[model samples]
Target: MPEVLDARALNRATLARQLLLDRADLPVLDAVTHLCGLQAQEPQEPFVGLWSRLRAFDPAALSDLLTGRRVVRTHLMRRTVHLVTSDDLLAWRTRHDAMLRQRVLGVYRTELDGVDLGELAAAGRAVMADGEPRSMPELARAVAGRWPEPGVRALGEMLVAALIPMVQLPPRGVWRVKAGVRNVPVSSWLGREPDPPAPDGDPVGETLVRRYLAAYGPAATADLRAWSGLAGLPAAVAAIRDELVSFRDERGRELLDLPGAPRPDPDTPAPVRFLPAFDNAILGYHDRGRIIDDEHRGLSVAGERVVLVDGRVSATWTVRDGVVATTPLRKFTRAEEAAVAGEERKLTAFLSGGDDQPTA
Candidate 1:
């Protein structure tokens, strides 16, 4: 019989893997790679994500990585923008192409109807071939005359997000800097194209399964699909099944995990953690019952910043005039309140540039 793990055990394992049990002493680049990537639809949120997970994380270091081309903000997993290492982008983009196109079409099917996708892709490449950064609207206008039926928003979204692999360049995501998105082809920005898909077996798919397990393992295939928005990884999982260990969840669903991955004890104490909007730690699984309650599940996708007490979401937090205000989802014990207050103070200091007046 596969070892049966309960929800608390799963929560502890998730907290450990997500670096929420304790802050990891790792460099910014390695941390980004380890988490696979930080969901970056809200540009500044990733800095906070890193701040919570890493020790003494310097936002400037992440900014430098962006300006230095070691990292990029691009559309990936779940057709959302993510802050990913350039190497992961190169290695993973091709595998995500079909899903990207399908998602765009799902949103803009009528507008994109009667359009030859291949030709539209060619025109988009031609427009971007000049090596100049362009906004989505601008790129769309440059080719809209040829496909006048589809409106600019529809055409532009498909072209910029799905057809062409593009990076949102700095200072769009630079630390403490605000700028509108300006896109350049990933190939031009990275000085090389994304890796081509294989003719035979799914190597990229296999890599994704391994990487997902490494970070969010002891997970079901449904959990993996939910995290990635990829419907096609079961084959990948099947191909590598022998290499993984399986366990049964309290629900009787089989969970797959990397052999040596940490599955911490359920009684292990977890500290107060402040997570940014859409933190993968909460959003990365199909069944989030392990870390968040069903009643509160909407909070994660709704983009509310949350506070974790004892490895489960306990409160929602927001900042107002340098004060971090927290609203409890449930009544907290005295110790939990103190831990949350202490962590919020640190978060406020981090947000307010080390100012001592950060009240919780």
Candidate 2:
């Protein structure tokens, strides 16, 4: 029988792998790659996500990466905009192409009825071939003549999200700067096309499994599917089965993990962590009991920023009028409150550009 990991053990291990146990000293780009990518639909949230996980994280460094094109905001895992290193984007985009298309179609199936998706994709690409970044509506209008039946919203969502691999260009995600999304084709923005799909094997899928376990390991196949929003990875898991080790969760479900990945001691102390909306650490598992209570799980998907206390979801936080307000889900010990206050002060300072106001 494999070792049985209870929820606390799983939580400690997850915190360790996620860099919450101790802030990592890695460069920004390397940290982003290690975690696969940060859920970045909110644009500035990745800065907070990294600040919590990294020591002395400079928001400007991440902004520079976006402007430099070393990192890109594109739709990848779960059909959401994520901040990913350019190399990962090039390597992983093709594998996710079918899933991206399917997700877009799922939302616009009725609006897009009678539309030839292939021809539409070609037309969309032609419009983007000029190498200029355009808003989704602009791109849609450029192609609407060919398919006037589907309105701009339906056509724009499909074309910008599924048909053309696009990067939400810089100035949009720059720290403290508010800008609307303007997209350019990934190929033009990154200076190279996405790597072609494998001819004989599932290399990209295998890579994703290994990467997922490295960051969120002891995870079930269902968790992998949930995090990635991709189906058909069973074969990928099978191909690499020999290279992985297994354990059983308290519920008797098998969990897969990389051989040398970190699984910290169950009793390890966990500091309070403020996570950005849609952070993958919380959304990465089908069974999130380890990191968040079942009753509070919906908060994760609802784009609520949560505070982790003693390694579990304990509070939700928000900024109102430059004040960081934290509403506790449960009673906090004096020590826990002190710790939360200390971290909250730092976070407020970061968010307000060095204004260390007390958290309400």
Candidate 3:
């Protein structure tokens, strides 16, 4: 019989793996890969995500990665812009290609009716083969002559998002820098081609499961599905289940965790940590009640950045004038406020590049 771990046990395990229990001494590249690529749709959010997890994390290190072509911002995993390692983007992109295409088409299938997808894919690739960075609209307009009636918005979205493996160019992800998205092929950016698709079943899927468990485990198959947006991973999980440890959640759902991974005591002291909007540590699971309250669970989907007090969300936070301002979702005691403010000060320094700032 699998031991049933309650919500608090799951939350502590999550915190330990996510590096919130204690700041990890991991390299930036490893950290990005570990978290399955920070939810980077908002561009600057990954920096905060890293800062909260790593001790003395420099925003410039991430910027250097972008400039060095070591990391890339691309559409993958649920059709969102994630700042993934170049190696991961290469190894994992091909596996996600079908899902990416289907998702984009799901939104624009009506708009793109009668379009020959094969010819469109060929033309889009031909256009991107030139090794130039082009905005989605620009790339779409360039191909609009052939697919004239598809509308530029639909065409551009399909090409840049689904058909092509393109990286959002630098300055878009540069530290404290603002720039519009311009895309170049992943091949052009990294000087290497993407990994070929698995000859049979997805080998990459198996790897994804292992990596996910190492970072966020004691998780169920549903949590794995929610995190990757991949259907039919149960086979992958089942294939590897013998290699993993099994437990049950409070709800009796079987959970799989890495054997050597941290599962701290439920009563372990967890300091206050401020999470960025769309932080996957909380959002990656199907049952988020382990780390967030049921009533406030909607906030994660809504992209509201939250403050974790005693390892559970007690407030929401936003930035104004480089100050991290907290609004208590539930009234906090003085000690909790002090802990939150102290952590907020650290967050402010990270955001402001080592400058001391007030945390209101």
Candidate 4:
């Protein structure tokens, strides 16, 4: 029989596993791979995400990782931009290619109708082969002869957003620095092409299951599907069930996790964690009620950054005029307010590059 873990048990376990209960000591590259990846469509979001989870995280470390080619930002899982390790990005990009293309078509089917995607990809690659950094608009205009009807915005959005394996180049991802996006081929950016699909078939799905369990486990296959946006991973989980331990949430949902992963005591005290917009620690699971209440669950999808007080989202926050401003979703006790203030102070310093200004 699966052990039934109540919401508190699950919450504490999730906090421990996600490195929110305590800041982690892992390197940025290793941390990126461990967390699967950080949602980074907004460019600067991953820095805040890292700052929240890592002890003494330097924004420059991630920036250097991007420039050093150790980590890369690309559209991968669910066709959203993520800051993923270079090795993981290369290995995983091909597997996601089909899904990425399908999602793009789903959105722009009418506009792309009668347009040959193969020819478009070929032309896009030929244009990128020159190694000059081109914005999406420039690339679209370069190939305007083939499908000029979509206009530059639509054409560029489709190509960079879906069709090609491209990386938004630096200065784009530099810490605290704002720059316009310019595109470069992933192969050119990383200096090695993404791994070819396995002749034995994609074991990446299986690997992803293991990794997810290690980092976000005691989770269900539904949770896995939610985290990955991949519909075909039950077979992957099934293939590795013998290597995993099974349990049940209080809801009687079956959960799978690595046997030795930290399932902290339900009473383990959790610290305040200021999560970045769309951080996967909350967005990673299908049943987020374990970490966030349903009443405020809309905040997760709406991209409102959250404040994890005692492992639950007790407040929402925003930064303006160099102040980390917060409003409680629930009333806070004096202790909770102190904790939130301390974390906000840290966040303000991070946002301001160690300026001594206090959080508003």
TM-score-better candidate, 1 vs 3: 1
Q: List the residue pairs that clash in candidate 1.
A: none
Estimate, for each residue in 1-360, the C-alpha lDDT of model 3 and write its tens digit: 988899989989999899888888889998998887888999899988888888768788999999999999999888888999999999999888888888888999988999988889889889888878899999999889998888999998888888888899999988889999999988889888799987887688899999999888989989988888788677778788789999998788989988899999999998888899989998789999988999999999899999999899889999999888899999888999898888887787777777642222
Clashing pairs in 4: none
Off by over 4 Å in 4: 355-360
Error of 4 at 154 (Å): 4.0
Worst 10 residues of 3 by lDDT: 351-360
Q: Which residue runs does candidate 1 get wrong by more than 4 Å?
A: 355-360
Output the lDDT of residue 206, model 4. Answer: 88
TM-score of each: 0.98, 0.97, 0.96, 0.95
In model 4, the Cα lDDT at residue 129 comes to: 90
Q: What is the C-alpha local distance difference test score of candidate 4?
A: 0.86
For model 2, what is the error of residue 183's alpha carbon versus the real structure, in angstroms, after optimal superposition?
Answer: 0.4
lDDT of 1 by residue, 70-160 (tens): 9999999999999999999999999999999999999999999999999999999999999999999999999999999899999999999
Candidate number of the best lDDT: 1
lDDT of each: 0.93, 0.91, 0.88, 0.86
> Per-residue lDDT for 168 in model 2?
97
Q: How large is the C-alpha RMSD of every model relative to the true structure?
A: 2.0, 2.1, 2.1, 2.4
Estimate the lDDT of model 2.
0.91
How many angstroms is residue 166 displaced in model 3 relative to the true structure, after the best TM-score fit?
Answer: 1.0
Error of 3 at 24 (Å): 0.7
